[model samples]
Target: MSLRAARDDDMAWLRRHYHQRRAAEFAPLGWPAAALDAFLDQQFALQHQHYTRYYADAQFLIVERDAAPIGRLYLLRRAPEHLLVDIGLDANQRGQGLGAALIAAAQDDAAASGRGLRLHVEHGNDAARRLYQRLGFEHEENLPTHAAMRWRAREPVATD
Candidate 1:
């Protein structure tokens, strides 16, 4: 129910989480177990390097509940907009409104900063797309593999 800066020790969990989150996607390929592990390792390493190099200033956070890690949220604060680089909850943690609550908190933070929040969801992830849309994110662009979405803070209503 809270976010904390990722520690060096968290890297192992992060890597395992990444693999668990992605293993299902490659399952349909019928790759051998060793091949799948190798592929996932390469992909994880590349993604880690890319995020580190490009989002050095971003908040690499571990989402925890009762002092145990349950997910990760990578957010980059920028003028005009804040980038939600990535968010992933443990498979067992999905649903039950946790993801929505976490995203709502991020939205609140973005609104307080007078900025919009943006993220890219894979086209194949219909559930995530629906969740983002329900959270008020609008389609900004369609990339080859992912959809770019943005959520702007609603202006306050005026009273007479």
Candidate 2:
């Protein structure tokens, strides 16, 4: 399997993934229905717009197996860190360690770029939060229905 930046072509797949997986977190957060509808459209449109400045800023990754896309990860850069805005593996691809592999890939990417791994998981998503915790991330803040988490590289060793 390989993980690489997603192409504009992958937008269709990404939207299908999100549309099918809309979080139950929003209802608890009281997110306005119309507001969420617009937000989702704008978020997906950014990838389709090839001429936008954000084209290069946002990172969309596609996980491929034997040249076929099996999963997607969407990231947003916010100055000090890379935020994991979305991640999804095909249902058949789940429970086979692909999710962990993706995070490991992100960890290496973050280490190389000198930025910490960051994400916002719905507060009610115990499954994902537990997975993040197991991957060495720590809770940083709560956003009503969600929580921000971070994984930082350990400090350098002391010289002899």
Q: Clash number for every model?
A: 0, 1
The models' CA-based lDDT, in order, is 0.94, 0.75
Candidate 2 stretches greater than 4 Å from native: 23-56, 76-79
Q: For this target, which candidate reaches the highest TM-score against the unseen true structure?
A: 1
Q: Per-residue CA lDDT of candidate 1, range 16-121, in tens? A: 9999999999999999999999999999999999998999999999999999999999999898899999999999999989999988998999999989899999
Tens-place lDDT digits, model 2, residues 66-104? 998888877665556777767888877877888988887
Write down the lDDT that model 1 would get: 0.94
